[model samples]
Target: MVLRSTRLRLHVGVSRVHRWLALIIGVQLLLWFASGLIMSVLPIDRVRGERLVERVSPATLDQARPRAPLDLVLREANKPAREVRYRLLLGREVAEVELADGAVVLQDAETGKRIPPLNAAMARAVAVQAYRGVAPTPSIRAILTASTEYRAILPAWRVDFPDRDATRIYVAQNSGRIVAVRNGTWRLYDFFWGLHIMDWKNHEDFNTPWLIGFAAGGLALAIAGSALLYFRWPRKRRRNK
Candidate 1:
């Protein structure tokens, strides 16, 4: 009698726990399924806005311009530069130097003179070089703060192109690098990504405590459901027999 009573208690306890777990984790399970489906349906390149971007061969710096002597530019800067390279910025030969102190300086290669921080015109020119879109000539939309699509590179320029995708390119002023390419497709992917990872703030981390706990609860619920099926099926078979 005691053994039977203990078995009954164990079965009830497992059933209750399984039911509660299902209640807690069911919503997240549905989200996982829906998010996964959306992600799988979209091609990765389109999701990343790569398909909208036209690949262009970068113009060689040393091809036609008579670049200033590298040693002279470094000496003129009067800083211990960690790296130096001659590049054409806005059709003008310039020396891009990165100092050991983490400062990036641009010098006119012809005159070996320091160029000022990029003005609106210069930013527009730099942005134009990086953009290859089927639109009217792209223009500077805004000097971005630490907001919008480019959270990674703050104080970047937002270059707007009149393309069908409403393409916007983020160019970093200091690094002179094309920081991010964004469009409608990427925004949708990012939305689903936030739902999938459950990390809305950064939109990247997947191993948060809440996600882990819900996943564990969902897994336990599935196992318990299987166990319940196993136990109930045999009883039904025995009764039929």
Candidate 2:
């Protein structure tokens, strides 16, 4: 009788815990499901704004053209070169020199003249060339620091288009390259992703304390519910023959 009473009390306690856990963890589970569904339904390419970008063949270096020697270019840069790349910037062949201190300098591949940094007008031109969207005019601004929307490269140009997608293209000022493209769809997807991971601030970390705690609670809830089912299931009585 004592054993029966103790067992009954334990069962009641477990049921209470299960209900509390359900109440606590249920909302997050629903959010996870909804976010997952939304992410799955959204096409990855559109999310990345890939369709809006115009594909262009990379400029090839002409070996036949007369060019300044790489040694001369490095000497003029004055800084120790960590890495050097020859590429065509706009229409001119330029030597992109990455200095030992991580600063990038552009030099004319033919004359070895130091190419000036990209101004707003030059940045706007680069954005226009990279974008295939029908937006007539785009407002341009220089982003000197990293932000949530544009973080890949520093000292970039943000060109905002007045289109349905509210497209924003980030062009690296020094490199004259399209670093990142962001639009309205991406923002929506990012919002839900932040919720799913429980990292509202960064939207990157998946292993948060809140998530861990909820996961533990969910596991406990499942175990407790299973125990209740086992204990409460009906059993057939033996024949009284």
- Tens digits of lDDT, candidate 1, 1-241: 9997977787787788888888888888899899889988888877666665533336776666576788889988899999987776767778888999877888988888888766656666666666656689777855656653567555667778888887887766764556688888788878888888888776778898877888778889988888777555655335555
Q: Local distance difference test, per candidate? A: 0.75, 0.86
- Give the per-residue lDDT of model 2 (tens digit) for 1-241: 9998998998899889889988989999899889999999999998999888753536798989888888899998998999988887677788899999998888889998888888888878877887878998899998988865666878888899898999998878777778888999999999999999898987888899998888788789889999999878888989999
Worst 10 residues of 1 by lDDT: 231-240
TM-score of 1: 0.80
- The TM-score, computed over Cα atoms with residue i paired to residue i, of candidate 2 is 0.87
Q: For candidate 2, what's the RMSD?
A: 2.4
- Pairs clashing in candidate 1? none
